[model samples]
Target: MGPIIGMSPDKKAETPGKQEERVGLRGVSGGPGTLPEAEYGAASPLATSLDRGSGGSEDEELTNLNWLHENLLQNFTLGGAQPSASPLFDIEGDPGGPLNASLSSSSQRDSLKSKPPLSFSLLIYMAIEQSPSKSLPVKDIYGWILQHFPYFSSAPTGWKNSVRHNLSLNKCFRKVERSLGKVNGKGSLWCVDPEYRPNLIQALKKQHLPAAHAFCTPPASPPRASSPPRHLFLQGCSLQESDIDAATAMMLLNSAPGHHHANPCDPDSPLDLSRPDSVLVSSDPKQDHNYSSMALQRCSSRSSSSSLSSLDEGGPSPGHTRSRTRPRRAGSEGFHSDEDSDLGDDRARPQPSQHRSSPLSSSVKRPVGKRARREVTAKPELDEELKEAAGSLLHLAGIRTSMELNKHSAKSKKLNRK
Candidate 1:
């Protein structure tokens, strides 16, 4: 071969250390001395560091250069490029590496996309079951699903139509009538049928979804019992003694003092005083006539002379006069002046037999002024007495008076004294 161009005959072969020096200088300066791209690839950071004479041994420099070369090949390679042979770049050895994390996240997304979402029926069941009333309207159900499942937030409007479709078609769900007075929109409440609840729970278990077991489990507490109906003040009264007209009985009840009006919404509320026709009268006409006659005969035969003497004595004392004005409770139906009044210091005084006569049998009519009537009716106790008397006469004929009434009467008398 001819002598190599640009080489003197006297020049000797360069050593490896001198060759490395020339290459690093060429890399730093971008001079003609730089090797062709095919020979050494791209400029290396390691060469720059070495040329800067960083404080490291030659072996350390060479090791760092090899590391740089491996990283460059691994990161910047084209399609089908072979992986670096260096153990530092081995992803299998680093389980917690960023590459592994990214791969895992992508796989999770794929799995989510491939797995079917919860069924509309199951979604509805969850919404209704979790509610305080175990029922929800269609709109509330939609809100609940969207709140619990983030996927539905961005989902199309078709899902809402599907939800309504599922509610209408599903046998497991049933529609309940909205309460009469409730103002919660026009939609009826939807609830899961008790007969199909177990089947739904079993189906939920079969789904094998995360946290789905919670739904399959029954509620920890039993359903709450509805509030008991309040007892009508006169529910215990059943007056069998007189031929009392239902209207008369109702009037007496309405005249009683201290009556508490029951809740209008309550199904078991007392007889509506506004509608007297609705009052239930149980007295037999024959029995009532006989009882009234017998009672009248007894009163006339036993007390004719005494009644005349009592009336001549000029009615009750002034202190006792206000006792009539005082509010009376339903329990005061059996109250007699001879019996102890709630006021311990007050003594019983004689009253006319006419005043004591049963209102149903009385021929005497005592005209009351509007103001006096207002004052009497305004007293809550009198209203209560009217209610109790009416309740007793209409529904509970022949029932004995309870000691509780006596005690209540006594309590009222004491309060009046105060």
Candidate 2:
């Protein structure tokens, strides 16, 4: 047959030669115009062989193709090459379809990832605010967070414990019991406190999430009456200049006259004006002299009482003496006669004056010993029983002395008889 129907004479002639060349280069057993399996591996052998035959000087093309061919065979045989999963390349005129879809999906994912997680308080506030009756059970709150935020879904189970902790500890959250018929859960439903709702809504708005606006609507406040101008009110109540002056004058006239001198009752007054002599109630010289005399008399009475107290505390001063009766002689007829003579002599003796030394003079002469200091500082009042005991002790001492003297005289009389 003269050249095949679709093949030109040159191609027909060259095809066998090209096939022989390919077979020889690849070192594979195959028929004329057949592709070798070793050259292309899993790739279409026909397409690769056609591309290899299409261009360039044989030596250069063969060198480049051989290198590419070896790499392709290695990758395909080892199962290292992977095909694109996207279908955009296979579709005829819509290459951008899968690419656009991928870009949009990636952008959406990035946006979700970029948003920072909401705080625990904010999360609870959001859940409560979005509830149908403005309250949700703890389980429902947990469900809401997992549903809205994908991050929490894969997070550790400890976050649920955190949610429960926030709900119980936050003062802004309040627990409301379900109605008897409506109760479906074990725990009470949680709601945001009304007083804190406005604050929570404001905080949510600051987050700038569009979803925040839907649940952040606060109730409108009642309109308030406008107050009158302060200046106008003051003008209506203001007093006239003439009336003010008249009021001031009347106040002065009604007030008591002020004393030019310091008041006697004032503790801050430097002088002791409480004394009659210090207070000049009248301008009379005779009344002033009388007040001075009365003040002097008061001073003298106080001094006398002080002096009596000092004398009682210190006993009699050195300038004074106590009178005592002489003890009677024992075992002699002459004793009775001598006792009368001694008593007469004691009575005839001059008594010392009962003079009290000044307090300054007594203190100067006081002894420095502990007992002496104690006696000087002792209270002035002496108990009557104590005075009687002291007197009895003195009397006993005198009787003992006299008995000793009587014994001595008896011994002397015995010696003279010997």
Candidate 3:
């Protein structure tokens, strides 16, 4: 059989149909390094170090579209081209300017004035397509939309700032963490999941002219291959994700660093855990546990990182996500957030980063903290809090299990915690 993700390279192979390469956008999960979650619709962060994009080689053309985006926008005025036949493809066939008919004259413009000219539509698009901006910061699919529509050029002056803020308020955008780096003396960290975006392009097209224009925008790369829906997609498949069983899970834990885990999340490449037959078991029990403990501690410390590694678990419920983003306009009978609403935090996907620097092995045994011990365990009294917390965490109960326990002992640990 041909080599699957995480499997050993195949010298001899057999398959019925001609295998098609999986089409993946460059930054589907986050950017360079990201883990899909399992809570919503994402895969577990533990199963494998999942990249943000679909399957491709390390050196694919879309690997880093940063240079391409930069040159296309900043250098366009300078008329710069890299001695290629075409630099920026004539986006949207716009001969005049980018924006179409303006709302400048109508009451619509006046009403929109209070609301930022920011396109919530674009930000959501970035998250959905898992595309990034020029900086490779969650690679917002916005640029692709901009390139596709090109009409926004004539929109307004403060449009850019409004757009940034629109993205800030977006729960999905916030839930997924990005690397914190400086851009033009300001913060430039970001991450997103295109599959989790509110509504699909076709749906957007049915709503607004501008939104539709932006949504339908496809890739600008010259067509060298015949394919429909030319834009790439990072899919969440059951067979692919569920294939990571317990034994394979153990292998992944072993391979990771004990005190510090780092997975080379190449979105362009196949998922390492998804195909385990090829995995080289290099786990050192001593180090793997230590490494994972520290990593989990670090993750637990970050409030915004709740969904850092579970996008797949939070699967693509585009309809649900769309409902969460209620229309501000009156008479809009869409979903409004409440206890029973599916629009709650459950719709949020985990943050992605530019790189997966370190992930503590979940399989590691941590030094029981004193507080954890005092609150719960008996023999490990010195580290009660840590022990209790660990037990509750392992058991899926909240830290309350650790905090509320009056009597602490190993014997009662299971019954009391459960």
Question: Can you write out model 1's per-residue Cα lDDT over 267-331, one digit (the tens) per residue?
Answer: 12222333232222212222221212122222222333333311011112113333344333211
Q: Which stretches of candidate 2 lie over 4 Å from their true place?
A: 1-103, 111-116, 179-182, 209-418
Comparing candidate 1 with candidate 3, which one achieves the higher lDDT?
Answer: 1
For all predicted structures, in order, the TM-scores are 0.25, 0.25, 0.24
Weakest 10 consecutive residues of candidate 2 by summed lDDT: 227-236
RMSD list, candidates in order: 43.4, 59.9, 24.7
Local distance difference test values of all predictions, in order: 0.32, 0.30, 0.24
| TM-score-sorted candidate list, best first | 2, 1, 3
Top lDDT: which candidate number? Answer: 1
Better of 2 and 3 by lDDT: 2
Clashes (N, CA, C under 3 Å) per candidate: 23, 0, 65
Model 2 per-residue lDDT at 236? 11
